[model samples]
Target: MRFLRRHVDAVYDALTVRRSRFVRVEELVIRAAGVVPGLVPTPQEIAAEDGSIQRDKSGLEIDQGLFLSAVLGSERCGRHLCHAMLLPRPEAQALLAQFERDGRVKLDGASVHRAGKAAVVTQDNPRFLNAEDQTSLDGAEICVDLALLDPTTEIAVMRGAVVEHPKYKGRRVFGAGINLTHLYHGRIPFVWYLQRDLGYVNKIYRGLAFADDAPPDEFGGNTIEKPWIAAVEAFAIGGHCQVLLVMDYVLAERSAFLTLPARKEGIIPGAANMRMPRFTGDRIARQAVQYERRLDCDSPEGRLICDEIVETGEMDAAIERVVKGLTNSGVVSAAGNRRAFRIAQEPLDMFRAYFAVYAREQAYCHFSPALIANLERYWNAQSRKP
Candidate 1:
């Protein structure tokens, strides 16, 4: 551990002293991997000791986790990491320009449209049931940036695009969570988890952070933000369900459902652990995350997360009405109220500390053999193709 810390600290110190330009968690991991070989341990290292069932923390995988936790937990390093995450994506400007010119920017897996007073961002990964993966990450984040930054829009709406899956053909399915087939095929990188949470997902919750400003700590930090509404059509599973926790309001179809099967997936379900209990209390949250309890949208328990349940085909009209209602009162105080509520519930420091632990633990889980076994047993991952 000491040896690993020395290398990580040295690299961290160099970046600090050099005042390096902003880089996302994924970039930082790649940079560190270049300097420290085991920072991104090989599959052999993960297979050795059989995923450390004895709780032995001496593997290179543990070192990877420790190294990341050390960097993410640091006051200087972690703050910059968070700031980099909150900054607009590289293609954000172009995309925003296109949206302003054409009223929409449609990418491969996602798109954003201007609808009345709201910017509606749609997730459109049809092949995998609107699942999130590398192909969709940047596009989704950029579209989110456009949504909040658009001067013409007072609010933002998140919804799923019609998917092509045989079971739910031409139906709007919110998301299937992570791309397990990609994960099993070694296409999903470890940093993808952090990127999703710290980048677009966090942007949806806390808004965009400026480069010259102080860390957006919810107390006095300045940010460009707007209230977000989530329209859940079919179901929100795992990461997508976690997103509902951050939204200002959630509108779900009567037949829709929600789940956080972290135990079955062998991974932390983003920030659901920290934010879900606030809505459903700790016991039900535990049941959902640990025991795979599914919450039906019409049920009393599900209502805690979903604000209104509409008929299956009434989602479009419901979204339009809700957006009108939220903006009709004049949303001048929307961002302020969001910050006020956030301060009492979850300040920036609390979220940062939680993610510090999450970064390390999730890295370990990502490489654990149990994750592979769970995917094969539960998801039939081996039979599926990316």
Candidate 2:
């Protein structure tokens, strides 16, 4: 671990200092690959294999994966990477200025509208039922950053915009998870999973790390943060369900359901394995993540994770009432209380340890033959158009 940490630190510092910006996991991996050949597949090989690089063919890749996992597992390096990712994104300052002036910022795939004391982030991939893809990710993260940084906003609300899909036209869908079509079509990269979990999703959970020199609240440093609320209309599936786990309050329409079908997808469901057990016990979490257990929003099991379930048309009113209630008394201590609860439940060290295992294992899963087979078998992925 110490050896791996030294290498990680050297490469991390070189990339960030030379580039004058924080390094993303993919960029770090690319730099590390120059030092260690065969650590990752070449573009030509990836194109030949359509992103599913067979793991058993290379001992170098396996050993390198384990080495990277150890580096992430180490407390010092893991915390360093986590803190770096939480720093405000490079585009954030410009986006925040626009948001402040117009009270909104609309991007290609998502948008943020300042509504009263809440910043509402609407996922807008309507044709795909608001599924997240490479196109939507950056926009979503920028929106989230503006929401948390806005001084006038006391809380954040996340929901999906109305859709263009035939079956669900004119109706809002919470999200369909990762764009499986893109995954099957080789558009979703391996590091994308890591970037999502460690970047914006973690920001939603832990808030923004404002200073490069200081740590997050869990590490005894200050952060600019606000409570987040999730509104689920149709359903929250796969990665979308993972998002609900980190939300402070979840409001779902009575007909909505939640699911984490990682088994069918043949990938880790982000941090769902580590966090869902807190909401649903070990047995249920296992059943959901491994066996595709669906929980209806109004059901007893679903109510454990969902704070409130409202009738279809009642959602707008419910959101208004909840936002007002959360801020009516002033959210002076919201950030502190949230940090206190997180430190007690999922301190940064625990998350680091879990990701150590996830980092290596999910890499294998992403490039595995099984992933392709599972997508075709369960999702009919081969027939879907990207």
Q: lDDT of candidate 2 vs native?
A: 0.83
State the lDDT of candidate 2 residue by residue for 1-386, as single tens digits. Answer: 45565576565455456334555665566666665565455444445655442332332334445555765776666677777778788787778888898999998778999999999999999988999988899888888888998888999999999999998899999999999998877777666777788888999999998564556855457788899999999999999999999999999999999999999998999999999999999999999999999999999999999999999989889999999999999999998899998898897788878888998898788767888899989988888888
Q: Count the backbone clashes (under 3 Å) in each candidate.
A: 0, 0
- Candidate 1 lDDT, tens digit per residue, 1-386? 56644565567756445436777776676566665666666555545544332223343545556666777776667777787889888688767777888889888778999999999999989989999998898889999999988989999999998999899998999999998887776666666788899999999988998877777863456888999999998999998999999999999999999999999999999999999999999999999999999999899999999999999799999999999999998899988888888888988778887898998899789778888889889998888977
TM-score of 2: 0.91
Candidate lDDT values, in order = 0.84, 0.83
TM-score (C-alpha) between model 1 and the true structure: 0.91
Q: After superposing candidate 2 on the true structure, give the runs of residues whose Cα lies further than 4 Å from its correct spot.
A: 1-21, 35-38, 41-68
Residue 53 displacement in candidate 1 (angstroms) = 21
Error in Å for residue 324 of model 2: 0.2
Looking at candidate 2, the ten consecutive residues that score lowest on lDDT are 53-62
Task: Please list the Cα RMSD from the true structure of every candidate, rounded to 1 decimal place.
Answer: 4.0, 3.0
